[model samples]
Target: MQLDEATLRIVAILFSLLIGGLLLFSWNSNRVNRELLVLGSSFGSAAVGIVLIGIASLGQSVIYLYTGVTLLFFAYGGGWQTMRIFERRPVKPWLAGLGGIFWLALSLIDPEHGPLITALAVAVVPASYTALMGFELWRGRGEYLPSRFALCMVVGLDSVLLVMRGVFIMIAASEAHRWTETQLTMTLSLLIVLVNVAVGYLMLSLIKERLETEQRAQTLIDPLTGLGNRRALHLHAERILRRQATSGQSVCVAIIDLDHFKKINDTFGHFMGDSVLRTFAERATLKLRPVDYLFRVGGEEFLCILQAAEERDAVGVMERIRRSMKSYRIGEGTEARGVTLSAGIASSRRVGYDLEDLTRAADAALYKAKRDGRNRVCVYTGDDTRLAADVEGRAWAEPRPQAGPLSGPQLT
Candidate 1:
């Protein structure tokens, strides 16, 4: 119940060191996360600054006080820089050093300033940095993180407290020299210790949540093509269908198979085959609208979901992608060859909103495209009637094979 200023400062120092060591240990496990490194350094610097401030208090030396305050400024700067790193923004080392530089300049210009001025100046540094950290987190609130809002609130509250403390120092300027021994200082130190613990825990939670999200995303992404995998399709299809149901817009499902993909793999090796797949993915992505989704469901096979597009629109988009692939050269120096893709499209108007039904219809039309000729687009019409588009962009009707229990390469 009777916590002295020295005892509170010691507790603060111990907490900083503990949090800093934990963050550094975590960073050691994953060295690529520079945010952890910067954050840990911030806490480490804070601990050193507190120790120096304790020494200054014992000796009653302005040099140690100023130096410690400067270190604390850099520590706050490090906190700001940690936010920038978390948001994937470019690091500005000069900006991070600005607070320290400003404090040092103030010390040089007004070496004989009263303790009130010094306390106010020190408060300004952490207040500005914490406010900036809150702003950075606010800007990144669009990202779904459970701990982000809590971190923002904590930082914002700390900033307000620091500003209020500065105001209190100004109001009680006569007692400024004995500020550290006051009850307010003791309370502030305890608050800093609590804030440090909360922020450290929240930051660790934020990092863990982010890593887990990315890991889940990786599982649903094709490593080679960088497109969504089948699992992604399964997850995302329902959302697309719900939107389509509400808007009453047609959704077109297209099953695309890389024509002669096996031959290319056999002739040029798997590396070149991979290059071709990546190239196709790039070209197809360029031709489709941002609202559309493309997934690599199987080997040399892809699925495209066109939002708010009818059958003809889907066919035209697929045709553009087909032509683009036709122009791309796989290899050079006499071994060069062009690639082509065949896509079968099925509209939600006819096939309904079910993903499985649309996939089956698209697969049927895709089979028709492959059976008729490669490098073409086919749209499934109810019954045995199918509309096929040739390389010349001419559409013709062809009889569909008898409907069996949804055959050939299930989209599951």
Candidate 2:
């Protein structure tokens, strides 16, 4: 097959971009290091692709043989590692290696016949690897969410190109009837190679997008508590407000503060103090509905946004959160110890109201809870009356059934 100089240049450039993009993504060390290994193998594949392009452009028999051999090595190695990544025992590499040896022998015997086997190997190896990749992704389908989805899409596209490439090569070598007259068999082959190069670039782009999304998620999440941080709270509130304004949906904002938190820091030391704070938020998280949003607004202060069916429903959710947090605990040095919490609830059903207004109401209720004495739950009604009352207080109301239990943050 003879590729035009212009077509060869385009294939070479696309392969170069694929290699560059893979290398760039590999430099980001935040993801599991094994993924970097995968990216490196992909880069190796791109390098082999470039070499093949160079051989095709020059029409050098020896170079083409070398390129075929190199690609087989890359395919086997990459496919093997990718299997390991998905926790599958590597299978395709052995077949691919055997196929590689077969093609090398065929190349020596007859270059014309060798293109048949080499093309078959090229097409089959990637096709098999792509199949395994799909299965691997499906097995761990939702384990990493959108990352797996991106991988599946990328690999699926590559597999289609791989199969198409094989058919193109087989037809080019053995027959010339399939392609249009203007589309030379060589040009068709080059076009298939170009498509694969494009697919590889697209894979790299997907990886980059996943990494960027993770970084963005990290910025919004509080590392210690695993809850939304102040920034996330603000952004989420803005979004909720926009939605509510358009749809007239009810939104409730609740404020929570740990009673006598400084005492925990002073008595237990700051490490245990942080643990208590984190545990409080974590426990609160379990009690929230999926539509409800929790945030670490400040030191020992949290805000929850509830998509409630009604104001009463929102209060009930906050009550559950209060009870759950009340039952959470922090370890006391070597021994586990229990802790309690206080929360102030507030909400706004009306659209176009500022988030700060709800915060003020919740804060007022929280202040009243503190003033009524420690370890109490209060609700802010939009009125002159303070929500704090002695009988309604439920903090420290539930005693731990066990004296010694693993406590504090629960390790996630």
lDDT of each: 0.82, 0.61
Top lDDT prediction, candidate number: 1
lDDT of 1 by residue, 1-412 (tens): 7778688778988999999999999999999788899999989998998888888988778777777877887888898889999999888878877887787777678766646556667578789988999898899998889999999999988888777766666556555454444567567657866886788778889999999988987888889988889998998899888899899999999999999999999999999999899888877777776567889999999999989887777887788788889999887899888998888999999979999999999999999888887788888886853655432444523223323211222222
lDDT, residue 259, model 2? 73
Best by TM-score: 1
| Clash pairs (backbone) in predicted model 1 | none
lDDT score, candidate 1, position 13: 89
| lDDT score for residue 128 of model 2 | 71
Model 1 CA lDDT for position 118: 69
**Runs off by more than 4 Å, candidate 2:** 1-70, 73-123, 127-165, 168-183, 329-337, 349-352, 386-412
lDDT of 1: 0.82
* TM-score quality measure for candidate 2: 0.67
